[model samples]
Target: MEIGEDYRDAVLPQSRWEKRKFVRCDFTEADLRGLVTQGCTFEECDFTRTDLGESKHDSTAFRSCVFDRTVLAEITWTGCSLLGSSFVDCRLRKIKVRETDFTLVSLGRADLRQCELSGLRFREANLVEANLSGARLRDTDLRAARLLGTDLSETDLRGAKLDADALVQAKFTGARVDLDTAIAFAAAHGLIISS
Candidate 1:
């Protein structure tokens, strides 16, 4: 389906975007805060440099979207599916994502402090230089994902697996882990501790 640019001009008000499909549209630098969209579909759209901060979405699906340099701070997402999305240089602080599927997403240089992500699938994601301080990552898969220069202080990796080269710059202050696992994991990363 071909999407028109004029549709972007119309007001997409909050609390009224359920099961609507907006494909191949340019939403760059758009102010979409506080917009509550449930079960909506966004395909092949460009949300680069967009301000989607503090938005609430439920069961929304975004496929093959380009969100490069987007500001997605303080967004609350639930049961959403974001497959094949690329988020380079994106900032995602204080985000609440629950029951979401982020398959094959590229989240390089993303700031993810105090974020809560539960039952999420981050398969094949590139999280380079991503800061995840005080973040909750339950049931998150980081297989084959790159995590160079990533800061993860106080992050909960209880049921999460560390991907290849995914802990280069991960910090673990105020974090909890099993002693054997902690010592083994940290030691493998050349982490030095004082007596």
Candidate 2:
């Protein structure tokens, strides 16, 4: 479908979209729960309050899109590129992101509780005030990311690559990390980790 030429509201929910391109489209209040998309591209699209929960995406690319108050919980994304996308006040609970690159994405104030984000690349992403409680971040890259006021409580950071500066700038109360990471964090703060 050629829905990228102009701005329009896409109300297609629970639809199967494959290899389609959507540019500058608005999906406000659209019911997209359980929608399946493969090899689709979304550029500069708006997804305000759109229900995309339980959606399945494979090899999809979302660039410079804005997602506000969107229901993206339990969504499964594989081989997706979310470069430069912004998510505000969106539900991301239980979302499975496999081999996805979120470079330069802004997830500020997004709820990512219990999400499996293992081995995902979040380089230069803005995560200010985002909730990541109980999320699995094993081997995730957080290089040069903004994390002020972000919640990492009960979140696993084993094998996660986060610089000392990034760790210091973020809130880590009750966050679970490996002993090596804990010692590194303590050492960065000039505190001695005792055996």
The local distance difference test score of model 1 is 0.74
Report the poorest 10 consecutive residues by lDDT, candidate 2: 1-10
Report the C-alpha lDDT of model 1 over 68-93, residue by residue, as the tens digit.
Answer: 77778888889998898988877787
lDDT of every predicted structure (CA atoms): 0.74, 0.86
Per-residue lDDT value at 74 in model 1: 80
Clashes of 2: 0
> What value of lDDT does candidate 2 attain over all alpha carbons?
0.86
Candidate 2: stretches off by over 4 Å = 1-9, 192-195
